[model samples]
Target: MLTNGLEKRTLSDVDVRDAFFDELYRLAVEDRNVIFMTADMGAFSLERFKRDFPKQYFNVGVAEQNMVSVAAGLALAGKKVFIYSIVPFVTLRCLEQIKIDLCGMNLPVTVVGIGAGVMYGGDGPTHHALHDIAVMRALPGMTIYNPSDALLTQASVRLAYEQAGPVYIRLEKGCLPVLYEDAGGGFQQGFTQLRAGKDISIMATGLMVHHAVTAKDILSRVGLSVGIFDIYRLKPLNEQALLEVMIHSPRVVSLEENSRIGGLGTALSELCADAGCRVPLMRMAWPDGHCREACGREEIHRHYRMDARSVAERILDWVRNT
Candidate 1:
């Protein structure tokens, strides 16, 4: 079955991690100045990097803070450094180092965070990165990029390497559905509207983009035209594009896997208020507290009411009430 004329795919069907690793390896091969560092994770992937460029790969066992600092040091010495680790361990655990060492120095270091936003669903709260966006977005000069699928993840890796500054990219453990067949649709450092509509606008980021697209389809089938925007860059938000969309639709909904506070919803709300555009705004996200148990990704998603069905029902209810 298809929702909103958009078909669904799973990570097992796509090769996101491999695609990202391949791109990283390609860059390392060409540029001797490129270095890969992982905090005891990504053994198989780092093995490939070490096999090709042994001198350029470093496995700093379980030291995310030290890893970020070391990457910043290397970047200062004119080296393109990429640090890879699990989301919570790398982003939250090393927040101070990321801010002080990387962002403070304005170094070109790419910190790749895996298991973003409960991708490691069965791993429990310690592993889930529900607040990485809010934490990373608060850091000055840090570019936060969240790719919806493997293709965009690869493109984001390439862009992070080329962009000058501290870049934080959130990646899943494996492949996700290919939202865009090619990156030629302009996956810039801002939000991009994936589908256009006239009734409501759905702003989403990370894995939620897939669900947002699904929700769009569900609404469209009921004769409700909805627009969907993939928020790739969260920190330096594309204010103009977001405002234009809000103005066009007048009703807006933001869907994210992270907490409602200080996430896409918060950012969009602020943007709308600043632009003096008042419309019906809704947010579908995790509540302010932490989840207690370790469960499957889909189970957790349903528990938080973040699935496509819940999103569609909520939007439809909102439309009906409004």
Candidate 2:
């Protein structure tokens, strides 16, 4: 039961990338066995890593597949390895390496992919990782996390470092809206309910968490009580929490920045069926396709009908009809 009353802070306010590197530096300092690998993209942050811990840093120079394989090999030798790169290049380009070398072998490698979803909005379709979730979720024994803000991002990085297994962490490009102030020291690797309501449940992830929060406010102004769930861990979802929320609300709306297929909606639907819960489910996400050109994040969201206004309208329509 997390409440959202803290002042909204942008990603820049928290130095998310620095926090990630700071944790890595701390871990590497303590554990001489830890190693960091990158596909030549972490120039600014990796500099400190290279200077402070030169022996533990490896720059793979654009070869994401080779980087992942090397990290897998290192992890197999009891070395805590982390692979960093942009979202598309890291996830899609190295899909085979990730699936075979890391996930298939059950290696404890932390694969950090920046610019998840449309975070690289103006960078065009080539850079947008619209299908990264679908791809990463298909891998077995892989832990997937999409942190809502800098705080959660730092927490996820720390957890990935501590946990043993192949982990995929999707990070937004820059600063995002801070939705949670104190997750009570830290949040667990599962969904956290941000707001509680009996009429509707809004299950959201990634950047959409902010939108869900905004939508909740808008819906509430209209005398609608909406429950909000921040789905931190995509795989190994908090089934019990989800079931309880759905059972209590009777109407669930899943919001995500990725496609409807194989994303939050798919997971929630499966959870409902598995729990034998009957509810009217609505999915708010990108359509079952790709975009043509580059656009701003807000424009893309509105074009796809995933903006706060659109979500609010959808929920209002559903409530009225019901």
Candidate 3:
């Protein structure tokens, strides 16, 4: 999976924390002012960050609110701070602090939220981050990046480091199969067209991206042309590119691991409406409900009928009826 001579590309497992932490460690080594704060959620591979950069690393002992406040203070003092924690704790738990301390002041703080969507499926609704995208996108001056693989995760980390405003890095909890051999250098364009088709456009992010690709193949076998849009960046959407892609198909479907309310589906709908594109938009997301069943991510996806086979079947049915 090493594409473009990258040291590491594809991962066989579902854990992406190591890849992110490795990139953070590299940035911390080069920039002494790069500080890392966590709310006691880095159990997989945070020891290296603490051991190597003792002065720059801190554990806030599960206090997400205080962690954000402290990070804001550090950013004000001319320090580049990176906050890491579970999706809910960092985003929903400390929403107020993030709005005022980071977004209001336009500070250059990188908030990395692990366990995006239902990657923590068995952990129940409390660990699920279904509404993170909607909540974070509402904030002013916040850039969102939800990478599909380890390669994109590295690029997102670099972008977060270079940018001068609040940025949210939404990462899936488990190790995901490396989908793109290359991210075309980086996620500067906000989205990338993986496979082109004339029937419908499937826009997906994070873990759903791989499923979108699978759905494309499945639809292709039935003589249906399917196009895939890997939307890693949510907010500050690449409107121009999305419009161009929508031109390929009249029916566009937004697939995400988040809620149907304010996730990628909403963003694309708003973009299409603004551009006056007359394409029919459909969103396949978790409905308004909590995940009461404790199961794996794939099981949850199957239950919601968001799996590759289910998605392709639904599209086929819609095409036939319409």
Report the number of clashing residue pairs per model: 1, 1, 5
Candidate 2 total steric clashes:
1
Kindly list the per-residue Cα lDDT of model 2 for residues 1-322, writing each as its tens digit: 3122222344346655665676678778889888998898874556778998888998889899899998988998899998989988989898999999998888889888887677777777887877888788888988899988776777777788877789998876455666666646567748888888888889999888888989989998999988889998998787887787788887899998887788878888988888888899998777777765578878878877788888899889988987
Taken over the whole model, the C-alpha lDDT of each candidate is: 0.84, 0.81, 0.86
Runs of candidate 1 with Cα error greater than 4 angstroms are 1-13
Q: Which segments of candidate 2 are over 4 A away from where they belong? A: 1-12, 183-185
- Which candidate should be chosen as best, given TM-score against the real structure? 3
Best by lDDT: 3
Winner on lDDT between 1 and 2 is 1
Please rank every candidate by TM-score, starting with the best. 3, 1, 2
TM-score per candidate: 0.93, 0.92, 0.95
Which pairs, if any, clash in model 3? 13-175, 14-174, 14-175, 15-174, 15-175
